[model samples]
Structure formats: structure tokens, C-alpha cells
Target: MLSRKEIVSILLLLTAMICILNAALFCNIMPIATSYEQLAQQTINAGTAYICILYALSTWVYHSNYSEPRRQIRYVLIAMLILLIAANLAGLVTVVKTLFMSDLSEAMDMRDLFSSFGYLCRTVAAVLFVITLLLLIIILIIVTITACNHSWSISSRQDSKEDLP
Candidate 1:
């Protein structure tokens, strides 16, 4: 079996790659933002990017501590991976839709190619992204506090040992 650190490393790498791909997809969709609706989509994309960073940071903090419940941690990480994948897939679909519509509009000499449905899809993805980020933030806070307590207790024990005759 892989060690805890190794597992964390792998998960972090996967998270990083997913975030990068998601950002790339958002960037690809950015050039067509010429209206308020498109601006809202861009805003959502920015928020999702920030949340992705928070998720990554939280994952690192939670996984670095060995005292946390391994099974629960594994489940949480797996859930996060699934959610991120779902969101990325949603974003990918939106990008494809936007590109296709843009092409069709261009060929037809139309002015706008964006669809409300695509915006809704992007909105759903952003919601998922925010949910995962919130979950990770909670995990990070709990793990950090637990780690501090553990270290404090260990230090007290060592000090007591040093005082023994």
C-alpha cells in the first residue's frame, strides 16, 4: 500500500491538474464575454478559481497530519475528487457548447452565440466548486487545530520527562 504522504501527494497532483484544466477551459471561454451575462459567467469563473486554490491548500493541510481518521479522510478526499471532476466536466461541456455556438453564429453572420442554458451549466459548476471549497476549509481548520494540540501535548510530556529526578 502507498504511504499516507504518497497518497496525499498523488491526490494533490490530481487536484492541481484538474484546477489547471478547468482554468484553461474558462480562459478559452473568456473572449466571447461582451455582455452582462457573459461578465457574470466570468465572475463565476474567477470565484471558482479562488475556491480551487483554497481546496488545494486545505487538502494539503489535512493530509499532512497523520493523526486524523484515515478512513474518513480517504472518503472525503475521494468525494472531493468526484465533485471536482463533475464540475470540470460541466465546465468542459459549457466550453464546447459556447465554441460550437460561436462557430455557428459566425458562419451564419450572427451577432451573439451564447445561450442561457450554457450559462446555467456554468453556474451549476461554480456552485459545486464552492461547495467543495467550503468543505475543505472546514477540514483544514479542524486539522490545524488538532495538530497544534498534539504538538503541545507532546512538548509538555517531554518537559515533564526532563524534570524527573
Candidate 2:
């Protein structure tokens, strides 16, 4: 099995890629200030990018063995992951609402290829976001448990050594 650090690195890379793609999709959809939904999507993309970068950097620090075993990095990572998941869900809901509420007759006119492409990209991004969120959650849980068990084992070993005559 891959180490926690490696898993985190991979997840962070994937998260960053997804966030970048989502940002690009939102930028192509419509002008940022044109609608509340569009503006929110842009904001979500930005926040996701920030959190992903932060978590990625933190993972490096955490795995470098320079910090205490109970560092706050894990808590921060969990919080950020939750935030990212929420933002993705919001974006997904907005996209689904737009898709359903949009006028089909106008869409069928085929006059605006960019608009159609934007919607397609948003749909694709939303699906990816869901998959990434699930992966992050699962990885986070596993990493946290592994870290806890590792720390416990180390402490127990030290205690046993101290008790040796």
C-alpha cells in the first residue's frame, strides 16, 4: 500500500487539477459578474484552489518529520476537505438547476456553441468534483486512522522500553 504521504500528494495533485479545470470552465461559461450563480462558481473555484494548495503544502511539511506528531495539519486538512466538498456540491447543484431551467428551444437553436460547450464543461467538472470529493474523504479517514495507530504503537513501545529492568 502507498504511504499516507504519497496518497496525500496524489490526492492534492488531483484536487488541484480539478480545481483548475473547474475554474477554467467557469471562466468560459459567462462573465464572472453577469449572474449570481456564475459569480458564486468563480468564487468556489478560487477557494477550492486555495485550499488544495494549502493542503498540499501542509502535507509536505507533515511528512518531512520536522513537526510534532499531533500537529494541527490534519485538522486543517479535514476542514479544508470538507469545505472543498461543500463548494463542489454547491457548484453541482447550480449546474443541475441551470441545465433543467434553461429553455430547450433556445438551446436547440445551435446559435451559440460556446454556451453549449460551457454547459457541457460544467457538467463534466461537476461529475469530476464529486468523484474527487469522495476520494479525498476516504483518504483522509484512512490517513487519520493510520497516523493514530502509528503514534499509539510508538508510545507503547517507548513505555515498554522504560519498564525494562
Candidate 3:
């Protein structure tokens, strides 16, 4: 039977797949830009969807222990979690800004509001994507350093035991 972590990882992977599919659909439906504003809006939506998919994949990797260096996994996990939280907060900020703004109704019609909101969301998601990428790189470095130390310690212990005998 799979462990709880494995189960969660699988679920996350599934979610990531769904997000990817949705992103593909969004890209497919994107209209040819007649103006700079239209191009920007489409680009933002596409970028946001892609970032969200990447974030989901990162979550899966963290949960699955796919390449986790055993000794440093906990620290890596914690750091990744912190970054994920920040990313989520950025997304939340985008939503709140779009939904609760006093001038939301006056800004544009329904279609315009949606496009504007998507653009803002994309901006936040891009920031989140960068943070998540940084977290992954940092964790990989920590894992490598700790793995080397662990191996060195084991070898030293074996040498000491041989000398005692």
C-alpha cells in the first residue's frame, strides 16, 4: 500500500494534469490581438495558467519524495512550503483586488473586467513562479550538501571502527 505522502503526491499530480489541460484550452481559445491591450491580456492569461501548472508540479514533487535527499528532505520541505504559501498569498491578493475593488463595475463591462482581472492574476502568478523556482533551486543545493556530509560521516565512522579492531 502506498503511504499517505504517496497518496497525496498522486492527487497533486492529477491536479497538475488538470491545470495543464485547462491552460492548453485557454491558449487554444486565445484571440489574435488587434491591439497592444488585447495582446497583453491574452499573454497574461496564458502565463498565469502555465505558472499555476508548474506550482502544482512542484507540490507533487515535494510530497512524493521523488528526488528527496533523505537527510535534508525536512528542511527542503519546510522551505518549499513557505514559498508555496507566499505564492498562494500573491494569488489571493490578485483575486481580492479584482473582486472587491470599489470601481470594478465602472472599470469596464463584464468581458473587460474579466480580462483585467486575468491580467492582474497573471502578474501575481508570474511572481509566484519565480519564488517557486528559487525554492526548488535552494532545496536542491541543500540536499546535495547534506548528502555529501552524510556520506562523509559514514565513511569516517567505518574507518574509526576498523582502527579499533
Residue range 1-165, candidate 1, lDDT tens digits: 974344445445444444444344534343554544344444444544554455556555655445446445544555654554455455545444444445576566332443565455455445544443444345445444545665677689889999999
What TM-score, computed on C-alpha atoms, does each candidate reach? 0.41, 0.71, 0.39
The C-alpha stretches of model 3 lying farther than 4 A from their native spots are: 21-68, 102-112, 115-165
Best prediction by lDDT:
2
Which scores greater on lDDT, model 2 or model 3? 2
Pairs of colliding residues, candidate 2: none
Per-residue accuracy of model 2 over 1-165 as CA lDDT, tens digit each: 976766876777777777777777643567656667766766777777777776777666645554454445665666667777777788767766665545664556433434667767767766766766676677678667766776678789999999999
Single out the weakest 10-residue window by summed lDDT for candidate 2. 105-114
Clashing pairs in 3: none
Report the lDDT tens digits of candidate 3 across residue range 1-165: 974434434443443443344334422233445334334433443443454455445545544434335445545444554554454344435434444553656766534644655555444444443443454344435445555676678688889999995
User: By TM-score, highest first, what's the ranking?
Assistant: 2, 1, 3
RMSD of each: 10.6, 4.4, 9.2
Range of the 10 consecutive residues with the lowest summed lDDT in candidate 1? 21-30
Order by lDDT, highest first: 2, 1, 3
